[model samples]
Target: MDISIHRPESLSGSLREAWHRAADESPGYANPFLSPEFAAGIGGFRGGARVAVLSEGTEAVGFFPYERTSLGVGRAVGLGLSDCQALVHRPGVTWDAQELLRACGLSVFEFDHLVEEQKPFDRYVTGTFASPVVDLKTGEGGYAQWLRGAYPGLARTTLKKERRLGRDLGEVRFVFDERDPAMLRTLMQWKSAQYRRTSRMDRFARPWIVNVVEHLFRVREEHFTGVLSVVYAGDRPVAAHFGPRSRTVFAAWFTAYDPELSYYSPGLIMHLRMAEAAGREGVRVMDLGRGEKEYKDWLKTRELRVGEGFVSRSHPVATAHRLWRRPVRGLRNTVLAHPRLREPADRLLKTVGALRTSGGTGSGRERSGRADPARTGSDRAGPHAR
Candidate 1:
């Protein structure tokens, strides 16, 4: 089989067609983030966003939506924070991962949450993390049953909290599919504020990110839909969650709540409502993406492991680059692995957060609050090929 790569000129028609074909033919193929529309929509900036079509003769067998970067690097579309699979490929294709890298002119391909199905590329990956999920197939009743059977104490606590919240707030209401754009704007503002407070990068501050999120909010498909659920206290919106939803999965992406309603745990209440709504919509899973949050443990029924690693072709430059980055990567990872440093890190973050809260004095806040609007388009005509 001869495998040739096609870097499409435009991601509109041809790219979507290829992605549809691959998705239909592939198992567990319902990842919205892997779709061409998603890549083009969200991966419109920061250079090196491209669609790679792998064909055996004339028929396309695989599609890889990637972003090329410096250090001869290639990353999965929406790499830094995206909680989805990498590379949408057909089931029976036999191609060397290295060959594909060479064909794409990539030195190193970095994936944070690489899927397990890409067997050829598994060898290059390291680091393992668990993604928590709630089974929603049985609807609210089913999940409720599981909750009682699995984490009775947590479920009781949540129910107690819900009651307390209602009692304290007068009346608690949940609105699913809140189509108000104002709500989204509010959520972005709150999320941005939270990011700054935490000394982290605010994704919504980036024009491309903001554009992509807004576009995705309007995108409605069987496999990929953005959900904006709001929890209300009386007539006031207290919490909002903007996440991606598929037929069987509701992926929790971004969420924010009013600090005034912190005593009510509006965020947790919203999540509970989200799970119930997902079950009603025939969604069987609510994926609370990576990271260890107490809420995830409280709501999750099981955990799925996803990995991160780098794949490189036998190019000398690529290998050298990988070797060079290894030590730095190791040091960072080591620091992250230690529990003792958490307090200091938290203190630093709190300090930065305080500064950001105080009214943006440093570069961190500046970088996090503003994103160039002009760079909200795909940059394909560059040395870095997707």
Candidate 2:
């Protein structure tokens, strides 16, 4: 019933230990994005980063990480970058959302990927969407053996393509945790090109996000570790993925492949390899994130629900923030929910992308790895790997 707010880096070691214990005790809270380390990483680049600790007597029972604007409007920490958000708490611990807001000195708090078990914030939820996940298990045999048994058809096709890729290139090898910093740069470059080609927001263009990824890459901890997996062919990187992992969960965040090798379905190969390696590394779930995509359907064992909404008090700032942000989110959700509308929107984006590419200063040759029409409706650059 007692709440205290502090800068993420200022949290005592004991408080972080309690936070980790809370994550271990709860199923959904196990995601790396909810970890104190992740919050601190974001806090390093984002000045608004903070954590709200809820306590009963001497024991800290809950942790809520968020970013607040000067206007007192707040949002989940790393909102656009984090795939999971929650008020991680010990079992049976509960607090009022409004009280927590007041304690944090916020007029409103908004989130897009709120955990489903947040009963206190249930009334504030406006919509719930399916977030796909792959439950991984290191079978009696290895990854290949398990894949064949679990998804015979998919394994057959994917494995065959991987073989072809190897034969044409050199050897196809997968690195579960690549340490080279250059590989990280390669991923960002490919992802940037992919964004430009698809006409989506280029997240890598922002220096802070770039810095955040680099900072996280060097972090090796029990609760949050940045994992960069690469699929290489004949010493050439064909596909790569960068995401964060906790003890039990690995979130699928940024993934990109050599566009020239799109015909071989390198992105699919990357996901399958990452899942296998994650299972061996003690990860129980590979969160594919919230989105509708064909690759997700083929790989997911089940789906978890995530909410998007605003929790607010009767303040003009809260009302104004809702009015401005809600409609944009509503339109995006509507487009993503219906394929009939989504297809056209995608086409228009590609068209705009083409125009931009033609007029841009970068040489056409530099963008060679992009412009794959086959990836238009599917998971080309990792946004919606449909």
For all candidates, what are the clash counts? 1, 3
Choose the strongest candidate by TM-score: 2
- Per-residue lDDT of model 1, residues 1-386, tens digit only: 45444443365465567677778676456656666656666555545776677777777777777777665678777776477766687778767888778767788887766766778887887777776778764523554564565456757765676677667775677788888999999988876766666666667777887877888888787667888999886678877888787656677777777655555555666777777767777777787766554567677889877777788877777777678767765654565555566447645765877866774532222121221111100000001100
The per-model lDDT (C-alpha) reads 0.66, 0.85
User: How high is the lDDT of residue 218 in model 2?
Assistant: 95
Question: Highest lDDT: which candidate?
Answer: 2
Predicted candidate 2 versus true structure: per-residue lDDT over 312-373, tens digit per residue: 99999999999999998888788878889988987788677777887553322213232322
Which runs in model 2 stand beyond 4 Å of their true positions? 358-386
Scored against the true structure, residue 105 in model 1 reaches a CA lDDT of 73
